[model samples]
Target: MAGVGVKDLLSADDIDESDLFDVLSKAAAIADGKLPARTRPRMIGLFFEQESTRTRIGFDVAASRLRHHIVDISASPGSRLGKAQGEDLEDHIRTISEYCDLIVARTEHVATVEEIARLTHLPVVNGGNGIGEHPTQALVDLFTIERRLGDVRGLSVALSCDPTARHALSFMKLLALRPPRRFTLCLAPETKLSNVAAAAIDDLRRCGTIIDRVDNVEATLDHDVLSIQTQRASSIISGRIGEMDTAQKIEDEKFTLTAEKVLRNRSKTMIMNPLPRHSETDKSCDSLPNAAYFDQVRLSVPIRMAVLSRMLAGRRWAGRSPSRSQPGWPETSSPISSSLSRSVN
Candidate 1:
């Protein structure tokens, strides 16, 4: 298996089928304790401009397990780089890049990560870029799906949530990049791919992903994987301030994932959620064998370990082979082309 073969991971489109497979294999190997430890002692900057539980903890634990020093930065009033202090984000990124071998950032704007990657020579991995993309989360997700199901190619995946969820969007783009031989994407009736994501959705269709707009949750549940992400229901009032508008309480039974729904297809279906979950999933369903959301969270460690290790494997400190020389962006004709191309320019 080769390295990720790129400097930065700004979107799911950054990785192709081969890279995806390599990363997944490496993740499994690392989890099994078969892979060698990273000899390099490097520093990783984990910077967050938004609140997170899974993405933040997963990366922190992954980097530590790989034996890298971590510099955790949060945009808070007590911190020097706090937005309230009127600190320039670019300056902060540039200063941090000078000290870290790699930078992983979660920001409320897509342009923030793009700008950081553009300004820094260090590899920049997007933790979650506002409503734009959550590439790393997507990687963990695909790794989990493939691990549990034997393969992602030709799998039946249903994404149920508000279409605006960045995780859902990034996962969709990932599926588009190396589409299955035969795939079915069952989307909720209220969930439609955003206009900005139209290009990627079209690419998936061209690559053999059959799109279906299912009107009922039960209809979507009869698949190999059911990914539910309804966190967008709680609107963010101020991301930096950690203020969120309370979500309107919904009594719509159809939208909820009760134990009954999980039992309906529990024998073969894998239930998933990139969660700070609201009412989309029922707690009663958590005990089911097919309820894989916890496994998804647990696997985030090894998956991210593979990602960080592969990205930094060739660093001078790593004492390994020289980094492969590849363009920052994929060829214009490739499906995995960088989304940062226009923004960086």
Candidate 2:
């Protein structure tokens, strides 16, 4: 139980295949309402430096459903992080770890998150660290793939986007552990795979997973799964690289995913996106059967729940066992008698 509390989900490499599968299985049960909800007073602290709609809301909702009070800390300009406050990153983490049961950190530097994990005693969840790794999002992606395809290891998966995006890089590393049979990366000439991404490719090859790169969309068309990420939007919007901001837009004719592309797959290919999508995916594909990007968002809640629950590994709280089907509980409604009356009729 002591070692089960994952301090940092930096890469897929952080979690072995068996552990990854177990967490995902539990997450699925929680999502489907098959498991009894836990009531724990454990407070989780959330720290986000970047703009996030899905990851932020998902953790908030998941923790609330599990009856955990959340303490939020942001890394915006007004916060202590921007002022170069009284303490360094490690000192702040060590200080905060004493106050909160767990820390969910989202920062611009992967090294900062790793340093925090190294220094803190409490569990640290990498919400997203720069272009480093986003293990939880990858978990949600794997969960969605499991639900739709029933298997992940034998499938052909394609990653399309800027290779430098940490999320994509992290995902490739994770895929290496599971070892997808045929893994293809679709990228532009300027977007060669980063050193981290290249190492992941090497790992994939060593594990007997076929790996390739193509600049053309048609080359990526054959894969059974597609994971499209738009993390570059944040980079471009911030104008980090000179004044260039319009690179986020993929030409409608070049990299767009429409209904026609969905129909082209010989076998129905599941489409995934980390969301906040740009011009890469057209609005028309939203209704397609193979479109699972929104499903990826929906899966985040249970995965967050699983993460929170795992953090409370050793502590024995007055939570109902996950085994019971009807862990009868009352909502914010009237007394049990009145609640039963509505159902009786």
Candidate 3:
């Protein structure tokens, strides 16, 4: 058994820039079918406590591609093995760990996944943890950005969503660790940065990331990358029938990414949505060249395959030397470079 240095991928804070880049590179190779197949079969457990489509399917496909047998364990509140059924989470995790080589868990609370990691000797991958962090999503998002835009450093990235969204927080946390020189992060009006996020923002600033809080969605559109996160309160629901009404009510046109806006800045900006989108992103914009949101979904398999392979193989990343000099921005610079440059100071 190869010992991948890290035991589990519970948070974005668990990985650094070098490891991130290396995984992405490996992902590209995996997508191209260049990587060799697994020598032996492994059993992977998919333990989802919340409703999901993308993350679950992506992991399932990734595991299958790597020749791993997947055992799906759905433990939603009302299900047979759910907490409501009198099953203890720790006991469930321990039992699952004994049968599976790896466990990918999505739960209602961050502490749930944390406890899963604590109790299990087997490696745990956080699929999505309540309002905490979705490290895998962040990895796929970064990979998509780098693939489409060429690089992540020095690009202006606007994360428009409710401040408490876990995916947004995880993305920001990852960026903070390996901040780009002269990078910009634009926050939506409703976003209230958590204390931890605020500290990360401070670190980004010190590392030369220009941070901006904007009221209008249009204000964020002029940047190099636009990432929209759908509001979670409206998205997560308990009952099946009542969810449609709630989802409809939460679709706000004000935050919608319209075709008109995409046309105006299509050449300069890349549009991204961490999916299951409501009215936040217009369907018409899907056909546009700069729309990388769907591509993010397409790339998730390879990215996840790379992640699982590394964790299972115990591969370690060679770290990069710290640099104080400003990194060069990508050749395809944003049109509003002058204004963006001023915002950095």
Candidate 2, residues 227-279: lDDT per residue as tens digits?
87553633642347554346655653545677776677553778888887877
Pick the winner on TM-score between candidates 1 and 2. 1
Please give each candidate's TM-score. Answer: 0.82, 0.81, 0.83
The TM-score between candidate 3 and the true structure equals: 0.83
Task: Report the lDDT of model 2 for residue 111.
Answer: 60
Show how many residue pairs clash in every candidate, following the order shown. Answer: 0, 1, 2
Across 314-338, the per-residue lDDT of candidate 1 in tens digits comes to 5221211121122221111222122
Task: Report residue 251 deviation for candidate 2 (angstroms).
Answer: 3.6
Best-fitting candidate, scored by lDDT: 3
Residues 1-345, model 3: lDDT tens digits = 234345778777777777787788899898777864656888889988787899999999999988888997666445556545467776777777778888899987656777787888887888877766788999898888877776678688877675456677678777775565444444333334455456555667777887666544666767888888554431342232365656655445556677797676544578888787777777888887778888999999999999889877766433222210112111112222222223211
Regions more than 4 Å wrong, model 3: 1-5, 76-86, 181-191, 231-242, 250-252, 265-267, 315-345
- Minimal lDDT window, size 10, model 1: 336-345
Native-to-model Cα distance after best TM-score fit, residue 72 in candidate 3, in Å? 1.2
Each prediction's Cα lDDT score? Answer: 0.69, 0.68, 0.70
- How do the candidates rank by TM-score, highest first? 3, 1, 2
Residue 254 in model 3: lDDT:
53
Off by over 4 Å in 2: 1-6, 36-39, 75-91, 230-234, 237-248, 264-267, 314-345
Clashing pairs in 2: 131-166
